[model samples]
Target chain A: MTYVSPPPEARSRGWYKRNEIAVTPFLFLIPAVLFFAIYVIIPIGQSFWISFHEWDGLGDKTWVGTANYERLLFDDRKFTTSFWNNIKWLVLYLLAIPGGLFIALFLNQTVTGIRLYKSLFFFPFVISQVVVGLVFSWFYLPREGLLNAILAVFGAGPVNILGDPSTATYGIIAAGLWPQTAYCMILYLTGLNAVDPEQVEAARLDGAKGWRMLWYVILPQLRPATFIAFVVTIIGALRSFDLISVMTNGGPFGSTRVLSFYMFEESLSEFGFRMGYGAAIAVVLFFIMLGFIVYFLWSMWRDEKGAR
Target chain B: MQSIFKASVAALALGAVAAPAFAESHTLSGDLRIISDMSNPAPRAVMEGLAADFGAMHPELNVELTIVDREAWKTQIRNALGANPPDVVNWYAANRMAPYVSAGLFEDITDMYENGDLTGLDSVKGALTIDGRQWGVPYTYYQWGVYYREDIFNELGLTEPTTFDEEIANCQVILDSGRKCYTIGTKFLWTAGGWFDYMNMRTNGFDFHMQLARGEVEWTDPRVRETFANWRKLIDMGAFIDDHQSYSWQEALNFMIDGEAAAYLMGNFAVAPLREAGLSDDQIDFYQFPMIADVPQGEDAPTDTFHIPSGAENKEAARAFLQFVTSPDVQTEINSGDGLGQLPVNANSGVDADEFLEQGFEMLTTNAEGGVAQFFDRDFPAEMASVGMEGLQEFMVFPDNLDDILERLEDARQRIYE
Candidate 1:
């Protein structure tokens, strides 16, 4: 049947006009927009405003421009230590990306009940951070804990893993990696599923095996998964608080104190509610996070532009 | 389409009807939220029972309770007190309450005192009173003392040490027996400070501690130095647990219970855990730390009280709850628990009334009679406590820098006062 095309204005008036279809997506997104505005956008703005003032959570707030920041920069030892430790955490925590890929490749076989083994490996990640901290702390207990018990069997002297300042932060970080590596492994496993079988067979035919296969063929295919794993690991390391709280409470002379725990300690702890000072610490932390976030976003943007 | 729209409208109407019913109850509407600093399950059970009783009595007031950890509790109380404090909640005594009271954060229960709603508040009245007006009602108070395992003492055939020399001898005996003399944890680090407080209280008395708290005396004063010297003597005699940096209060208790350690220099709160371990009252005993020959006596007890926040929603209800808590009946119930054998603030309530509280009462009352000092943290401002705790931790970890440590503390004190 021959049909005449309607004019633009008439099409706009029609039910399934371009304008109607275009507006439909935004209509469906109203609830999400409202939620994001209420919970995320507003709070970030409020926190930034509060960062500039000297206000306890309750009483009258006094405007003190840049004083909190000054204290955070020059006065607060806890803040400095925590920030430096966060740097260490970020650097060390990214090790999980490669480690996860290694484990995923090892366990990605189509053997019988390999699924059960994968789930079991992922079990630590499934448990709460609080439980992981508790389990690790008990494991590291010097006198009667599982670690000490194991050491005793070997006739080795007991190590106070959590108590010793040298090992405490690293010990907690190791516990964090237990779940983090599992998470990365799951991401890689999904990425591995979409790998080109024909290319793998061709590579095998060309005598590319093991390390050569992984470096030239497999890892390149898992680029998206690796990036996600690295991003999450970095964020997890920077924001580690629960395990430290549960395990050490920044004890043994505040040696294990991190930015998040230190911020909490400074603001609302028995040390006194120096809320302004706390905000300054938070601002420093936010900037540090912003730096990482900006780099990641810039890289993504560059990749998108290059693709176009 | 019409039928679906009608059903949707009916469902929306029903949801609107149900929303108000969720909040509107025959039972009390708002939860009578009580934020306690006591997070341990031992006291939690007692508080829960008390809450249940309180709820049953006043059906209109629903009591929802939470026990915040100590550090969080302090911060939360500070935050809550300024704008929207709990109607009633726990607070520390004396110097600790001064800042809150000065800020007008706590409600004055002066009426309770005048009307005789609080009968024996006059006795421990100094505890909750800020600026000569009552800000809180005392719930529990306990003396700081050496909590020794009577079993260990019996095993070594040694008696409780009454004098400084004898205390050293007791440590000597324990060391001779191949067991450590004391069980302590410097991991959380405050347990070490308890020793310093008690020693300072015994060596220097209340006036000296008050001076220290006020930033009047140098932290490097000879009196403070002498207290450290005494602590060093115990250290020299090998009177403390090995690897003390590895444990918390409960972990230290485990050492004492297991017979790896002889004594735990702690407050009466230690009794509850010992009791929980099935150790009878006779298995554990308390004694004041030995006196330095020249130092005047000072009280070394800590007191916990309830203060009304400045912006309490239910002022009358909060006041009534505070008054009720300090009443003899409720105080007696608190003392009945092994975890809270803290002396009752109401002196007239008498120790003989509650079998459990009698021992703690005798200790606190005796210290009060002898002119003892307040516990260290209670006597000092929060700023000072922070520095003092750090100093104590440093002293334990590095005993040789006694002079340097004192100087550092003095610097901290100067900074805080400034």
Candidate 2:
């Protein structure tokens, strides 16, 4: 190859190209940033803006200045019910993580048709949550449902699970947990595959066995999966709208309502679209979710620093 | 083809001499979009066929009809009407359309009626009128009545109850015979409103019911309390099925169909489901809700309406389509036979020979002088209706909480109306 030493412009172009690395990443990121801004970020800001106004969606917005928040916090009984229901959902929904870990551990061993067993275990998560909700709703039907039929055989229940105000939220949450548990199981299964076999062998040689071996060694290795499962399950619980919508529509006198469903109902024009009020509800929900997200980021950052 | 060619040549010659007249009769060409909630198989098929028939009649016009699921339609309608609205939209007749109309989301097509292009909708015109102006053209409505199992009634030596006492006694007898007197499902919430409407209208009379629906009367009014008290009687007698709140309206009908429950207070649309459940015509029967205190017997006949959105781009085409839909022929086709099984609003529309429809027509026409209510949910503002229906459901589950429920409903009513 001949060296073209006389080309000064080419040498300068090389300098510019060396600096282009930083700009190239940003250029590649622009499409995603634009989409995220348009679909997610801007709507969030708009919801915050709408929360301060009294607008019926189609009409001119009147600035009401914290009136919606005041009503939500003080006046609305439905809002209070929905807020408590959301808390109940969050608390109950956390059970999926451990339940999933147990299932993943049970199915992690190699055996005949192990792959088929794993796939079948993941089946509920594969279907849409809407479908899961519908199936669970049919299963919980007071008279003609599978659960009631089984209960009838034992002379126990013709219990109206989704009908009674006391049990409706728990019933929906249980339905939600089915798919959520499957999702966690899949996450843990992948995490288990990536576990270092050498570490397990070393721990076994040290006389560690069963629960202690798994808890101290295996679980520590699966931190990333556990973190992901926690984040997703928390978000899943907070944003549970479709299941409640499909199952009860926040019925049996609005006993099963969660915050998301309440926000939707408030802003639905069919229910007279109190847009400002709905936006207020959304802002409260956003703050709640933000608390979890911030906590997650803080913990992740701490873990990252500790690892380094 | 030859006749068409000859007619075109003659039309071309005549168009030159009478350009204005030709233009007047010429179908305006544009995309006329209609959004409907006729999502059920029978109604959806009828609506689609009607759109095709209308498109055939007007060759220049391109009709686009979007049928959406009923629940989805409720959330979608605001966006559908607020932004780039479809030319025509289907909605409930009265109070349900009021919010849209007040927000100027719907166009005033009163001219269509005055211009003689639309006629013979006197029965339902009142529902579409607000503040001395017509806002929509109603196409279909159905009667709400007590549908009972005739075989069960015959076996119990019972007849149709005409008075409140007789009805309570009949319910007592049905309970004694180990059957539910009424079956209702409140899982969707609106089903409870049907019971409330009949009780209110029967006790307080139609005018008071309308006033209450409009929020002119407080929910805690003595008359309103009486309505709840009467409803309490049914609950006390164990008239309704156990675990009524767990089922949808369709699922609740299973109790009636299986002979566990004797009667259901529902619309005429429920007949198809009953028949599909294998009930023969003779096995089913209808009766007006029993009189409570000798007040004029009002009937709930919720009418379905169509209106042109104010933001619609093709108003002329939309108006023409509305007129086409309300024509006697189209009305007859939509209302009669196995389509929607609803009553045609147009007086000139041909009647169906179905016994249930005949009974509904007779009952509705006779009670016409008293007034025809557009059920509780339809007659009240959406916000008020939501709150009111919630209260009704709460009452169903806890009849002893009537006082608190009414107070809460009054609070919601004041908040909404103000």
Candidate 3:
């Protein structure tokens, strides 16, 4: 390919032409960048802007700067309940990662119909969260549920898991964990397949086995899978709206509200749209997520730099 | 389907509105586009029939009807009303319409009431009014009351009580018989609000209840506390089903159906379901939520309405459509047992001959002496209602938390109304 740059007109736009190799990637990125800016970044800015005003979604915006936040931070009991429930969700949801790893290790071995076993273990993840919520809600039904039937078989009394405010959030988290654990198990299973067997054999030869081997040799090799799992699990815990919506609609007296569900309840729910207050809630959620995001990015950067 | 049919019919039969529907003598032209949320098969059919009938009447006019999913229409309503709205759309009455009314998204149809054709609309004028002006007109509503298992009452040798003392005595007897007196699901919170509505209205009268709904009264007001105390009487009696907070209102029906719960303090909608569940007409019956106080009885009846958006291009035709809907004949046809299965807003409209409808219609039109509330969630502002219902549910569960719950609701009422 001969470069035809003899045209004087082309020279005037020479910078781009000369740097086309470097600039072409950015030019190619234009569409994705524009989409992200419009759908993601702009909306985020809009949310922040809305957080400063009192808007009923349709009516004129009344600038009541910081009032929403002040009420949320100090006066709102429901907000306090939602924030604490989110904490419960985050802390409990991490159990899925460890739970997934255990199941992954147990299932990684050769067995009769191992493929069937693997898929069976992964089945929960395949179902939609809404389905999971519905199934769990039915299971928690005091009289007509399989859970109570099983409890009866054991001569134990029925427990209304979803009815009691004290236990409702935990019940939903447990339901959420069912599918999340499956998701993490799949991640770990793939990670295990990529494990260096020679390295594992060497570690075994040195008397490393069970928990010791899992902690030092096997885990170190599974860093990328673990990282991805951690990221998804954290985000899943934060944005745990569907299961809450389907399972409880943040009810049994709203004992199961997390930030995401509460935001929907305030902003776009049939109740009424307090878009500004919802945005303020969203803003708080964003900051919380931003903290974890910055940490994850920093860790990824550190890893990349070390590799370099 | 049978339950909705029966429930709505019973509700209509019980309605007391006696407004005379005047025929529209004027003719209208141009496109009358209507987007209705009557997406349920039965209501959808009724809405289509109304549109078709009206279109047939106005041969020179084009009637375009769009039936949207009831749930989906909720979020889309604002956007639809904001930009290029249809000529008329389906919406709920009361505070549900308040936001649209204040924003002027809805047409100020106060002048429509001045039209003699809509003279019958005066009775339900409150439901569709905001800021001392009418914004729309109600098409249908159903009565809320106790639908008890007459079989259970018969088995227990009991009768429907008419006063608070008798109510307690009957509940005690029902409880002693190893059955719950009431089967309520507070899972969604609104069911508890219904209980609160009856208790509060019965205890404090309808006007006081409305004042509380309007946030004119504080939650911690002694009168409000008295309402709670009255509700606590039933809660403490364990009258409601066990573990009710877990069940939806639909799911709670199992107890009533199975005879484990003696009654349901519900809208007339429960009648159809009771009949479907194999209860004979004699096995189930309607009653005013047995009067709890000396005050006049008030009832909760959430009215579904139709409105013309201000952005409508065919205001003249839309106005005609509104008039047509509120007219007595259309109201009777639409509210018939096979149509919407509910009461026509027009008091002059004759209801179906269904037993529950006869009782419900009689109750609402006559026995509902104090006032007709648009249910708790409807009458109260949305945010306040949401918070209030939650507090009410909490109170039902933990009666000792009354102080805390009242304080919290008082806070919400202050913030919400302000």
Candidate 4:
């Protein structure tokens, strides 16, 4: 009576119920895993497959082995230009982080209507990139734009910012940095808000102040925000397409083209769909991004292990 | 129930016997989809109105029109015509439609031409024909020429240029007067093709331009270099507005309208924007791009066309829509509408009362003594055109690099055409 054995099915069901702790988390992960595979993982594999073939978006696919990659590496000058521009974008876009930190520090105080001031400072991040691009294009307009007008006031003649090959990419990058800087500012602002007051007081007691106090005391606490800002800024810079598209359209003889815009122009432009070549470009970009992702994951893993 | 069944069978047999005789008058009913690049408000509204009118005439048919932005439509059209194809789609005549035709994405609509008056559509019909069969029905076409400021000319006491030398002299006069001779926007790349079309056609004439666009001639050929040489003369004369690469065609018009530039080489569609900017017919006028090398003037009059997709679910309904689109009444309505500002392809469709329209027609028919050439980008394969236009843009930006640009274009041509 105390321990009567149940039927085999009922006994197995009880065993399953007892092991729910081991299985429930995986069950919860199924939906996310499925979506990730469908949207991200599957497309990446398909892009790799497409890179081996010469296919217009509409017609039959013909396998051409590594011809697309060969063309990209050796034959295509536009590809080289785009790769260089992407590198430049990656390097220059990092300025947003310190720029944001400067602004966040300037507005970190709790004065009256400080909330309004913070929102105003964060306004650029809220506007659409397309609108930002248009604003920047108009800003750089050769004769009548704001930049030219401002120059004229100082007895300096107008300079074409977006029309010249030398300056066009920088002009677009400057546009991208406006919103990126605002984004970094908000992240830093939140990080600053979470800073421990007791630590600041302790540092003050030790006569630490200004650069010394901030570097020795505050920066260590802001690491998490800095990590996130760095990750996003890198991704943002790498995917800089909308601004270039709207502002210069990779013009001034295709000098402003980044990898993303070039890929689009190659495969989906009025130039006729070179799906194979576009896929090859995408594959190259994927590997470059994968390198960053692996480093990021490895670093994060190390940090987690250290924290434990 | 049995008696009723027998009666129905008898009725069916009788209906089948008479079906053939009544087939010509049968009303077609289905959803017709037309994907068009009429994103501008005026053309979009005009197309919408025409669709509504067509729908009204055939109550059984439903017309679903999708008007997409021009640049977006270029990409989307491939998908639209490649898979789940629309019943009808808008495209340019001649070489622009050639790829789709070769891909068998568009239907053979030669029968539609036989059913309509083909007189007025002779030029465009020739353009839309491939393998001696018509593939599309052109609805509208407009001439491209130098739209100049009449008031500026009168003020400077400068006469209209008739020869290449006179045009160059005119440019000098404008330059001396501290004004630019032309304003062109090369940002979209295709705008540069307009200048190339004018230069090539003026230098070597129509046949050569067509051959070059078709990739039959080497881009590095001496004759081609001469065309570039002539264009270099214009560039060296300071003919164009500064920083043209940053502006779109619409943006470049600002210079022309603001009196900073004296003229623009553009299609008739530009007239609406110019008019909107407060220029009247009296203030502005059209002139053929002047003669160069004494070759026949091969004018660029790009024709807008519509065609049924091969994968259309309802061919009959699509054909009806095409017929409606090309009908003189509908053509007249479209041309007269404020949006298109183009001439109708139907000969019976009377010309608009507007002076510019009248003059454009006269110049295209009587003055363009050589023949009509589709715009450079339209007349060439998209891949070749893209490379060609890029070379043209590079030349415009750095004329000293003409040889390098030409060589690069030649490389692309051999690769693409191979």
Worst 10 residues of 3 chain B by lDDT: B15-24
Best of the two (1, 3) by lDDT: 3
Largest DockQ belongs to which candidate?
3
Off by over 4 Å in 1: A1-34, A270-272, B1-87, B114-117, B220-223, B310-321, B328-334, B337-340, B353-359, B368-374, B400-412
What's the candidate order when arranged by decreasing DockQ? Answer: 3, 4, 2, 1
For model 1, name the residue pairs that clash. B105-B310, B298-B372, B298-B373, B299-B372, B299-B373
lDDT of 3 by residue, B178-297 (tens): 999999887888899899999999999999999998889999999999988888888899988888777788889989999999889888777766778888888888888877778888
Q: Residue A175 of model 1: what lDDT?
A: 85
Residues B164-278 of candidate 4 have per-residue lDDT tens digits of 8999888898899999999999998888899999899999998899888878999889999999999999898889987888778998998889988999999988889899999
The TM-score obtained for chain B by all candidates, in the order given, is 0.85, 0.92, 0.92, 0.91
Report DockQ per prediction, comma-separated: 0.33, 0.62, 0.73, 0.68
Candidate 2, residue B198: lDDT: 89
lDDT of each: 0.76, 0.87, 0.87, 0.86
Q: What is the lDDT of residue B31 in candidate 4?
A: 91
1 against 2, candidate with superior DockQ = 2
Model 4 Cα lDDT, one tens digit per residue, A154-245: 98988998988898899999999999999999999999999999999999999999999979999899999899899999999999999998
Angstrom error of the Cα, residue B305, model 2: value is 1.2
Model 1, B145-201: lDDT tens digits are 788889889988999887888888888988998899899988777787788876776
